[model samples]
Target: MQPLLYNMPTLFAALGIRLKQISRIRQETDDSKPHVVELQQVTAVQVLVKAGQHIRGEPVEDRINSEEVRRLLDEFVPEWEVREERLYRRFETANWRVTLMTANAIGFLSEAAYHHPRLVLNYRSVEVYLTTHDAGGLTKLDFSLARKIEETVGWPRSREEMPGRRPKEWLRS
Candidate 1:
């Protein structure tokens, strides 16, 4: 057999099937073209939702409406904004080390969730742009990942009086 070769995630997403979680990924052999031997799927997570939120379109996995997006931003992720139909957030760090750390943290979260975002890192800041590209706009996945990112990365600065050596000026905005 000529090895099963194709972009599985892209193909499945193009067909309206969202792969929510991935436990791990390991290569089976060390060759010029390494084969992905393991791909594990996990369960879904709960996210904030307003009652009677109408989800339109053929597939329920399609893009979320602007009104709902507005509500989600206002209620859940106030720091994030909608730009050109993508969920956006900018973290202003203290210096280069903080900037790189923030970017890498986001990259780790994005990978674990299997919902990647476009990250732009600078000397003192990192910009995150998220969207369900295959679904064509923002969706539950985007919101969930954003929430996770905030909880993990934003916690140090968000808490009123966190113990330990958490830097006070680690992140801003």
Candidate 2:
């Protein structure tokens, strides 16, 4: 059996057939079985590092070009601006309390996505700047995370109604 199996590959190659193609055809015949399954799982940090390497090594085709960036700004996130290959947005709240709440929410979203952005917190506002430093410009990750941040914070809301703000009782000294 071992010799036959070893000779099978050589026989297929001699006949101008590919072993991979034969295996794929066999897999297709078995409709009850899954062709792919989850293998070993790694931490989010590892995934981010791999993604950064891929972006750096490959062409910028995956990155959002300037034209699409401008279109996205005009259509969805008008408040966001493009400058020097970065997407910038500033959100104004009614007070410092609201600013903190928004900032925390943005931070959480950034961590969850594994894509960090530059955030500047002010007395009543927060400025967010996003760009793919590895790609040297904007990428879909930046825009997607920005949209998530906007949705998470519900920007432009007043201080009294900012999302994720704890009540006075929940506050610690």
Candidate 3:
């Protein structure tokens, strides 16, 4: 009897398909001079990995162009500056407590988004820099995180708008 076998690993790799599992298939075979087999059932789960595409069908993140970055900065986040292909901002706090508070806020946002940033903390200031390391440059993730940080830790004068007691100096951009 001749048995037909497939080199599944090699086949899957060549086809750019990731195999999850394959259950046993019931096969029908006839005994004769020439062996013949029929596959009754086959089940498979695979992920197709295409070039510049994620396995889960998510689009690959691309670096933003300089012109696009500039336009984004001008239109939405004028307070942010792009340098060395990174989105950057600095906030001067009233004191060490405010500095730590600002850093904690940024850390929380970064952790929640699963995106991290480079933070330089001083006695009375915090400098934030964001770039997507995997993408090798800034992407939407960086901009979105930066915007969240700004909204969470607003400018020093923003505190004046609060109804209750407010510190004269909280954070200055």
Candidate 4:
């Protein structure tokens, strides 16, 4: 049997599809954190967020040991809660709770969701966990957010003590 021109075009389309294969997500390295996330053209860095335990992941180690981490935390992150949602504390825009209702962290979690879409957020006694379903583990996004949370809440002691962490600044947030 002979194929028609229309059939010829369809065959070519099929060939194109067959020629392409989806990319896979892979771990990141050399970032000093010792772990990273890169998948299907997406890039993410994994940072460990812990409350107690003193230590675990390499990121935590770096943060404590690295003078850079110390400076960023000391200089950038406000020691007290800010009135806005500018990474210091939860405010009108920076409020994650509200963001959760509206999924404001959508872009934040997009990459994690793309690869392992399944995420389980557990607010434990001391800390919260954000893990990826596809990766079957937690990624840097989780830790980064956790660190943000710590900063947002004024250094992780408690909401009450947050104000004491730093001096009052009307324009802080």
Per-model TM-score versus the true fold: 0.61, 0.54, 0.61, 0.23
How many pairs in model 3 have backbone atoms within 3 A of each other, for residues 3 or more apart or on separate chains, i.e. clashes? 0
Rank by TM-score (best first)? 1, 3, 2, 4
lDDT for residue 52 in candidate 4, whole number 0-100: 20
Q: Over 4 Å off in model 4, which ranges?
A: 1-39, 44-70, 79-88, 94-98, 101-173
Instruction: lDDT for model 3, please.
Output: 0.62
- Residue 83 displacement (Å), model 3: 1.9
Q: Tell me which residue pairs clash in candidate 4.
A: 28-36, 46-140, 47-140, 85-94, 116-134
Whichever of 1 and 3 has more lDDT, that candidate is 1
Q: Across residues 16-112, which tens digit of lDDT does each residue of candidate 1 receive?
A: 3345753334445676554442334412222212211222222335578889898989887887898878999888776887787677667755755
In terms of lDDT, the best-performing candidate is: 1
lDDT of 2 by residue, 51-124 (tens): 44333345442677778998888876776788767899887665787677667667745654556789999887
lDDT of 4 by residue, 1-173 (tens): 11111222233232221213223233345554432222222122122222222122222211132344345445544342222212222322223332332122322333333322222322211122333333333333333544544433223243444345542311122
Give the per-residue lDDT digits (tens) of candidate 3, residues 80-114: 89877899998888799778877876774575455
Clash pairs (backbone) in predicted model 2: none
Decoy 1 TM-score against native = 0.61
For model 4, give the RMSD to the true fold. 18.5
Query: lDDT per prediction?
Result: 0.63, 0.58, 0.62, 0.30
Q: Which stretches of candidate 3 lie over 4 Å from their true place?
A: 1-60, 158-169
